[model samples]
Target: MEFENRDEYIIKKYQQDEETMIQLYVQWCSNHQIDPIALYQRAYPGQVQNESLLKAVEEKDQESIEISSDTLLEVLQMFGNDDLAFAVTEEIQKRSKR
Candidate 1:
């Protein structure tokens, strides 16, 4: 409950809750009907998109996609969704044991 280093905690928490973060990203992509990897590429030109993520989106295979914790944070932050990003990070820490 007490994090001496909050940023470190957040990073570790994100890694632990990677599945939930990926699910949230998939839901967001589905709701917006936009491939998150593409969107990320557009947002940060010259940045390589994740091939697996692109393939998953192209194939409409949500279950096969795996999103990195950093990418999840970046995409969410890029879309101006600090609250959801924070929630996902916190949820990862909270639900890690389950």
Candidate 2:
């Protein structure tokens, strides 16, 4: 449980909470009528390699788009949902502990 750095610990937790992050991403995207995959790609560009996640968005599958926590927050903020983005980050940090 000991982390060498705070960022390392936060990244670990963020990865652990991928499902929650994806849920928040989908909800935010749906609420704003934005394409989750497009937003994710825009946030990370060539860094995105999750075909399943992209496929989910391409197919309009709301419940299957699994986005990374960092990408989700970036996309949210990109769309001007700073409050919701912060909430999602807080929720992910909380859920990762459990």
Candidate 3:
């Protein structure tokens, strides 16, 4: 692969990784029969639509990926999405109590 600039290459790699993260999140939500968008809204009330998330959901492919709660939380935190991770944690706790 050839890149005109190192910055451009870095940015492209980051975007691709971010896309994979989003797709994983979406797949996790589907596995648990949860609405990813609604969960996101609860985490970020009054915020506008998350374009990346929406796009991920819309373009999601049917893949049977088993995502654990802990794994999802860690991934969200890795992406600096503490709010969303909190929401996911709450959901996990709620499910456990049921």
Candidate 4:
């Protein structure tokens, strides 16, 4: 995931291979019938060591990285999470407009 200044190819490769993680996330969220947008807000407990996505935001950080438009569709497809992608896009848009 979040290698600082890494090659684009490497990031995509990782995203493709470990995509099951996101798939699992989608399935779980769907089963819970939870608002996907709400999931973005609940604080994750403890230090989560996500080997992929390569970076984790601290509990206090509100701004997430802009998922590049070129890779946006790929990310949506990879996780079967259009809602999450849209939510992220909305945040990015709101921040940009600010």
Candidate 5:
């Protein structure tokens, strides 16, 4: 796809990266048997739904990828999703105690 300007290209690249991040999150949740939507809702209580998350769920393929807890947390934090990152941390802690 062609972008009109450098800014547009940057934005497009960020969006694509964000999508990858979301996919990674969803896959991580699946790998751990955690509900991604429920986790997202726990992070953002005000929003009933996350469109990108739902889309990722719908589009997820059979292939599975390794998503480390630390990597997922760092990626979420890097994307400015501190709340979600915290939620994931809490989840990790909860799972560790089990």
Candidate 6:
């Protein structure tokens, strides 16, 4: 799964797009059948990027989220290492209760 030098460069460049980030949010939510807002609230701990992404996805703003393959890759990252991610989220939630 190692990327070539060019591939890594492309991924970095691709990640620079806000649209790519938004699309990742959309795909991850769709794959899990959760609303993007709820998915962000549950999976990621902050409102900055995730909430913005959810808004972009749900609003269908047609800004460019759906057109980026790099975005799709980011969505996969949210779910792929999901065990650790979810575990951390749970702890955060638990701590919030105190």
Per residue, candidate 5 scores C-alpha lDDT tens digits across 1-93 of 354687798999999999999999999999998899998999999986878899999998778888999999999999999999999999999
lDDT of each: 0.59, 0.61, 0.88, 0.46, 0.93, 0.53
Model 1 TM: 0.38
Model 1 regions lying over 4 Å from their true place: 1-13, 51-75, 78-98
Q: What lDDT tens digits, residue by residue, belong to model 6 across residues 1-98?
A: 45588899887776665565555556544544446665455555554565556556766643442323334444545546354246435544665697
Question: What CA root-mean-square deviation does each model show from the true structure?
Answer: 12.5, 11.5, 2.3, 12.2, 2.4, 9.8
State how far residue 92 of model 2 sits from its true place (Å).
20
The TM-score of predicted model 5 comes to 0.92
Regarding lDDT, does 3 or 4 come out ahead? 3
Give Cα distance to truth, residue 9, candidate 5, Å: 0.3
Give the per-residue lDDT of model 1 (tens digit) for 1-98. Answer: 36768878988787556544445576555654445665545445565665545654565654544455567778777656576567556545655666
TM-score of each: 0.38, 0.40, 0.89, 0.33, 0.92, 0.36
lDDT of 3 by residue, 51-86 (tens): 999999998888687988888888889989899899
The clash number for model 1 is 0
Segments in model 2 whose C-alpha atoms lie over 4 Å from true places: 1-16, 55-98
Count of steric clashes across candidates, in order? 0, 0, 0, 2, 0, 0
- Report the C-alpha displacement of residue 12, candidate 1, in angstroms: 6.2
Q: Looking at model 2, which ten-residue stretch has the lowest summed lDDT?
A: 56-65
CA shift of 55, model 6, Å: 3.2
Candidate 3 has what TM-score?
0.89
Candidate 4 ranges beyond 4 A from true positions: 1-16, 19-67
- Order of the predicted models by TM-score, top scorer first: 5, 3, 2, 1, 6, 4
The better-scoring model by TM-score among 1 and 5 is 5
How high is the lDDT of residue 62 in model 1? 47
**Clashes by residue pair, model 2:** none
